[model samples]
Target: MGATPYSLVYGMDAVLPVELRIPSQRVMMEAGLPEFEWAQARYQELHMIDEKRLKVLYHVQRYQRLVEKAFKKKVRIRDVKKGDLVVKFDRAPVYDHRGKFRPNSLGPFIVNEVLFGKAVRLLDQNGETSTEPINLDQLKKYYA
Candidate 1:
């Protein structure tokens, strides 16, 4: 548009054929255009472009922060205590989701104490307690 408002190209740095540039530069010099005017025009144009770019960047950052906050929610894990009736996973079928779909839970076990790992001591509904510890993830707290 209107010769791109200004030409910041100096012939020395261009990869264009020398024949093409020499003739155009000679014409510009004859027209009395000063090199200083060309340099200043380039600097002003870049400043405007940079300012607009900064504003767009700032707006995008604010939107990202808002979305992150909206997606954020907290979950608190409750402590398992003694005499709590709980469900423990079956040993043979860790891959099955069918039990989770049904009421696949077994127990109403009483928690005796925590062992090493997520393992805990528990007493079954019939009063049998496991000697080996089990992970808490396999169990759910029984309300009734």
Candidate 2:
């Protein structure tokens, strides 16, 4: 939720829990108010909570966009076209018969089709196309 837990639950910024044990300015101020007036104030705050929540939602979206832009600046954009050769990223390590370590990428799989710029369908070494498209992030261009 966009609103802070404290504000959502309390319909205002929550005073520190210690404020209840010790006396804080807010506690002391509210303490002097008659019970009926205090209840009325709380009811008013609750009625305006929707507007407060809207403000928080806008703030959260703005912050998220800022973070996204910062992240995109450091991203290495990869582009692939039909017929390009690429290697799939392997999640597990592979060992050769000679006990040598294998590279984390496998295959000079052929790019059979480029889909939506974000993913590509590949052709296996046998020239059969894979059923599912692989995300471009999981592939690197194959020079050979």
Candidate 3:
């Protein structure tokens, strides 16, 4: 374990010491080497730091993709199409005062258009199109 989280992730000691312990003389002697050799090794390690950080980033991205794949596999794809009847969920603002038993959703709106990326334009009973496209997640198939 390293003294700090940054040291643990990056595999380098921090510039500022949080705590210190004196090494035993015997341990120091065994680990000690010529100053020039130690400097060269330290320089090599410093040169490789960017590569190590890039590898960590790549692994994190790969892990995210795997998790996304697993999640997508379990999701039920909505089969909405143009002209389908669907109900939009009501997302009322907190300031709006409605009855406790008020319906939590609106519409049996007709699907006027199925746009790109799971969005739809809706039509009310009067055949007027909605002001904006709604996400498919906010709707479900409406059956009479």
- TM-score of each model, in listed order: 0.40, 0.54, 0.60
lDDT per residue (tens digit) for residues 10-31 in model 1: 4233334752433344444655
Best by TM-score: 3
Candidate 3: Cα lDDT at 43 = 69
State each candidate's clash count. 0, 0, 0
Worst 10 residues of 2 by lDDT: 93-102
| Best prediction by lDDT | 2
Per-candidate local distance difference test: 0.70, 0.83, 0.79
Which pairs in model 3 have colliding backbones?
none
- In model 3, the Cα lDDT at residue 4 comes to 82
Q: For residues 1-144, could you state the per-residue lDDT of candidate 3 as single tens digits?
A: 427888788976444332123233333335786666656765666678778889999999999999999999999888998889999888776554556766878988999998998899999989999989999899999999
Ranking by TM-score: 3, 2, 1
Better-scoring candidate (lDDT), 2 or 3: 2
> What is residue 30's positional error in candidate 1, in angstroms?
37
Of 2 and 3, the candidate ahead on TM-score is 3
Candidate 1 overall lDDT versus native? 0.70
